[model samples]
Target: MTAPEPGTDGQSVRPRMAQHYSVAPEPDAPEGYVAPGMPGAPVAGYDPAPDPAEPSAGRRRRRRRRRTGLAVAVSATAMLVGALAYGAALSRVQSSIGWLAIALAAAVAWPLGRIGGQNRTLPPLGALLSATGLLLGQLLGQTLRLHRLEGTPYGELLGDALRIWRADRHPVDLAFYGIALIGGFLLTRRTASTD
Candidate 1:
């Protein structure tokens, strides 16, 4: 069989070659329309969709601050309650049950630290709050005791309480204080992530 001639059997060789090689034409775009990723595109009214998986930085920061604030408030309130309870008990009872304060401090501090979130500042904050609570409890107990015994005036109660607590200190009290400090510090430490 010989080579097919042009337009043979009503089919042109040029048309077949053109059909094989021709590229599809691009669609016409509207005026002022810029294709995505093109340089200097106006992008009028174009708001990029935010990523749902990742929150905005400002939102994250605000959330963190709110959490930290809540933690601090709750921890401080707990310490205040513990101190008041301890002081009340100590004032009423002549026996030395100060060791119980260690448990109270750890109990309050550990949960506070965990609630405070994973941060570098939590342990030190817990320890400071614990120490403050213990000191306040002692002073308050002494103040209440003096008030009960001598009807001490409100203005002079603090000074008298300080003097009384200073005079009443014992070596055993120091040991208990140190243990409380250690417990608060250690128990408030960040736990390993189970995740």
Candidate 2:
């Protein structure tokens, strides 16, 4: 019980025990001198060290991409099959009549395909062009059918169809709706993968 060492309020003073008896200074490194085996460190002329794991990284990346693509493709195909079944269920409405809906769907699909094809290495322009051609072909087919069905010419056919669909509430197949939805999903996934 010697006199308490002073702290802020004159408490007993005591030296804190040092954990280390002594400390050594780090070796002084010369300018640009790097220790051996350190990353980016120069040894003599600084030859590039080969990455031992690069090939494995690349393989794993490719495998991941393949799996993703396979999953997406399978899902899309399954959806397409389900949509076809819905179309079949509506078979009574005269699928010949329903081709109009198909045509409209194609028209919408082409521009979307064009957008999807942007800057692709081989340029998916071929797919876009096919979509456009299919849409136009559908239009022509409708025009021909219009002449056969209602004594209308190719010129006045579009106006008549518009009037019919607009005035008469024809039942639309939910499958086309499904196609459009799935197509959008496929487009987004494909774009993201490319990036």
Candidate 3:
């Protein structure tokens, strides 16, 4: 085959080689071939030459995938550990406190799921605020339910606080706080991908 001559337009009209579309070189070993990494041995697809950039690109992709996997593994491990610790603590609590704690945990997880869905980053302050708000919401919800069931006036106070909270941007505040967790996860993933 004749090599195409370079032209002013920077296009070569040479026929394409089948190797261009093949993942591996022909099975027949070429004589005197030596792979860079395999030194002195006939490497599977050793050509006397190869693009230096190809190896680097592969390495980069592998590194990025490694980091992502590591992050996911660590996140899962942390969740499991925290759940176990909380369960142990919960078992030792009084029934009332246990139920309250379970309610609060459920509330906290809801916002956490939202944050994950949004894929946002959360700073430490935001984490603290959201956790506190979730716990408070659960506590208030339980208190209101209990008082209302007993047909007492205390339920009215909860209703008022809820109204004031709703009117005074409590929902917005909680949303802002929850956003942090999403942000944290997103930022971490972004960094991992780039690695």
Candidate 4:
């Protein structure tokens, strides 16, 4: 066989290679296949490298998600523990100790605000959830205690709990919620992405 001559452009005078094409399978589509353009169309060059900002953006997002989750978990745990502590103390200390529960609620905001993601809304959101949980816990304990005293039946306990949930809340309880809300706003701050 005769060797092919090189082009004057310093490139080999070679036959064109077979073109390659790829299509994604779609169940609902015709023939269960989907391609960018019609058949026999010129195949455009495709750069597989991802965008410059994609990895960083994704990493930051994942990091933020982790931080947000951590903040929420911590806040919730603090609120529950606080509620239980306050309930236990309430049974023991005769003097007023409501402030302790409020303080606990307020304290949750610090960690949440400090570690919660860039969303300025998260701190206050966490605080609100925590405060609400605290109030619910207190009400729950009160309802259980009252029900026990009244010798409430197991089947009717649900009704009693509902009544307690809808009962008029004390101003002190409202104050605690407000403190937690404000404290959350105060403690929350934007932090640099660690990743």
Best by lDDT: 1
State, as a TM-score between 0 and 1, how close model 2 is to the true structure.
0.31
Q: What tens digits encode model 3's per-residue C-alpha lDDT throughout 82-138?
A: 444443443344232322333333333333333332223322322343345444543
Better of 1 and 3 by lDDT: 1
Clashing pairs in 4: 113-188
Cα-based TM-score, every candidate: 0.66, 0.31, 0.27, 0.52
Query: Which run of 10 residues does model 4 get worst, by summed lDDT?
Result: 186-195
> What local lDDT does model 2 show for residue 139?
43
Off by over 4 Å in 2: 1-93, 96-142, 167-171, 191-195
- In the range 2-86, model 4's lDDT, one tens digit per residue, is 8688899977789878766596544576663546696754467954568786776678788888888897788778777777766
Off by over 4 Å in 3: 1-55, 95-195
Worst 10 residues of 2 by lDDT: 121-130
The backbone clash count of each candidate, in order, is 0, 4, 8, 1
Q: Per-residue alpha-carbon lDDT of model 1 for 117-184, expressed as tens digits? A: 76567777777788778888888888888889989685789998898789889998887777667777
Q: How far is candidate 1 from the true structure (C-alpha RMSD, Å)?
A: 10.5
> Tens-digit lDDT track for model 2 on 78-180?
3344334333333334343433343333333333333333233212322332233333333444445556678866578877654543454434533433444
lDDT of 2: 0.44
Q: Which residue pairs overlap in candidate 2's backbone? A: 4-12, 5-11, 5-12, 5-13
Error (Å) of candidate 2 at residue 8 is 75
Determine which window of 10 residues in candidate 3 has minimal summed lDDT: 117-126
